[model samples]
Target: MRSSVRERETVARWDVARPSWPSRTAGVSLAGFRDSSAGPVDVPLVPHPAVTLVVEFGDGLFVVGDATGRQQRGSLVAGLAPGAVRMRGENVTCVEVRLSPVVAYAVLGVCPAELDRTVVALDDLWGRDLSRIREQLADAASWEDRFALTDSLLARRRETGPLVDPEVARVWDRIVISRGRVRIEDLADEVGWSRRLLWSRFRSQIGLPPKRAATLVRFRHAAHRLAAGDNAVRVAADCGYVDQSHLHREVVAFTGMTPSTLAGDPGLAVDDIAWAEPVAHLGVMRKT
Candidate 1:
């Protein structure tokens, strides 16, 4: 009976029928978006700690790197983007999965560090596996099926791929659960590792060192609050900034926009339609 109950729970957890493909799996969430615009729309992609996988089923989605000045069109893996980027495409339809850095190595077969502030074609990373998934996504009958296919593929890949160090995973989870409020020293102690060793391993596997990762996670929470119509001053105070000035600097650094401008950013506005609920479910978007 317990086994039967567990099976039922598992099915319920993987139910792809949810609004934005909230998964029962930790460290993974998926969202499907469809746009019919004839001309391209620019979306200011915010830098976050997650490694994102974008699979397009319709028109191409081009990732334009602000620094590299190169554009990658079609399915891709965006790794721990350090600064703002933009996505330009028209009549776009895609399924985007955000992977917590903790599990990205297992799913992508590459350390998040390799992708730091870079975008690579998905075919380059996953090879033929990505092409196969794209075909499956395009052929799938409905959004639910597409999500289910995506989830099953991720689950299979993660199960087969090598995992990050357990200690590193624990530290990442702690930072995320604390919404980036925890200290690196405390995390090292909790995970039974010296600070130096923890820093090295964490950066190698998770893309960013502990301190920077914490700040990125915190900033994402603050960005969401601003988008939700929270006052910039209150958001700064609530998200642990030293002052509104500090908050402004962090926001500008990550997004290249001031707090008020970020709040009004049409690009940042896509979170409402595409990822708002799944992000909250992932625990990245915290109540604080």
Candidate 2:
């Protein structure tokens, strides 16, 4: 499952790999990346609709920083829709896991509400267990082995961790299935919960209120479409935006970049290879 990505007109290349099969746990996906460039790499981190765990194992420095200038070194966890972040490193190698907010609570041993829009050291949450997992991944012989180790770790954590309310999970699935176009009121009706109850439960369990979650999902879809070279005007309409300006605003809010700049972002360019399965799970595809 190894693929090579070389940006046009540049010497940057990435060795990206994915698991041979899906994770045993649902709502989890993994990808591995090893930088092949001659020097340090810095890429803007685009906001997405899932919690992210980066397990760094290479003999290099890995740093994540937010717009506020806070930085965390080594492996880290980013909450859903962490705004205006960046990743920088030299000779980076890591297995990146994207966990749907629906299951992130169980797998991460913390309420999503607690992680909302923040980046934290994985060691702060997982403590010594994070160290053991990093060692296991570094000792693994191949990317497939690393993926297996990660999946096993997540499955074990999920078994012992608390679960989100079923109603909340249902609403999340609906939001994703509609590509964030579903109304919160409609979701409340479908789940037989009052608007107030739905908002509270969804916010605590999903790390974001229903409307904000919907906006994040919608923005994720539009961002990927823009990254695929779609015109902002057409993408806005297709992704439920009022107009191109609406899409531009959301893009700026989420990534601190205009739609055109995001289209050429190096971080997103590798998504087609690194996140193919997860992107497909979201019912979107990168343009070939």
Candidate 3:
């Protein structure tokens, strides 16, 4: 997705690159983005089920905050936040990693729950190590080299960080496999826990409660389809929404946009460009 000037007079171009990651790096995928723009720009970002790590090496980027007027900096970790967000930046080059909530704790040494609906500086998680990584990334000769450095760092963290509860992991896997269509009660029963216990544990481990996570996952699928030119009505039906209206509400709730507006959103349309190649590569790695 070569970003071009939009109707709003902002000249923007984004190039995405994929790097080979280790097979042992399960539940994670990496993408590199190079953005060249005339000046500062605002891009809308909607909610997603997974956590994200953004490391920027060019002009600063920050998550635009509401009410409190607090902005999260580049080189940040963002949890499964709700509503809409606008990323403000100019001439940014960065590497982004998408981490499944199941592996977030292991990779970051922080429970997903503590990060619920929030973004924080990566240094807050990895301390001085983040500065060192940023310096190395800035000096790296190629995107592949930067990716390798990041993979090594995350691998070490995952190896040493606390493991998630087995039952919690199982519940998460089921939700993904079902594409968020699975019932909460069914998940609770499958995990051998009462509904109350399952709810508490799942939220603690995965950030969002089971039901909310499922909704996000389902909405993510629908959003991608819409971005791919699928009809909203068909997407709603295929994604298990009651109807187009139901899908509309979900889209509005997560993105603060109507279905048509979200379909035209460049930030989301670029996700395919950013993730498709790396995700496909990761799948092949898993099979081997």
User: Global lDDT for candidate 3?
Assistant: 0.77
Best by lDDT: 2
Write model 2 residue lDDT over 116-234, tens digit each, in one string: 88999888889878999889988998777888899999999988988889999999999999999998999999989999999999998999999999999999898889876788899
> Ranking under TM-score, best-scoring first?
2, 3, 1
Give the per-residue lDDT digits (tens) of candidate 1, residues 158-245: 8887778999999988888898999899999998999999999999989988999999989988998997689989999999999999
Q: Pick the TM-score winner.
A: 2
TM-score of 3: 0.88
Candidate 3 Cα misplacement greater than 4 A, ranges: 1-12, 59-63, 66-69, 277-288
Which runs of model 2 end up more than 4 angstroms from their true locations? Answer: 1-12, 278-288
Off by over 4 Å in 1: 1-24, 59-63, 278-288
Candidate 1's TM-score reads 0.85
Higher TM-score: candidate 1 or 2? 2
lDDT per residue (tens digit) for residues 1-288 in model 3: 323213211222466667755435688878777765556667775677789888777545545553245777677887896366667776677888888898899998899899887777887898877888888889998877888888888888889887778998898888888889999998888878999998898898889899999888899989989977899999999999999999999998777789999988877755765666434341111100
Say which prediction, candidate 2 or candidate 3, comes out ahead on lDDT.
2
Q: After the best TM-score superposition of candidate 2, give how far the Cα of residue 163 lies from its true spot, in angstroms.
A: 1.0
Model 2, position 68, has a per-residue lDDT of: 96
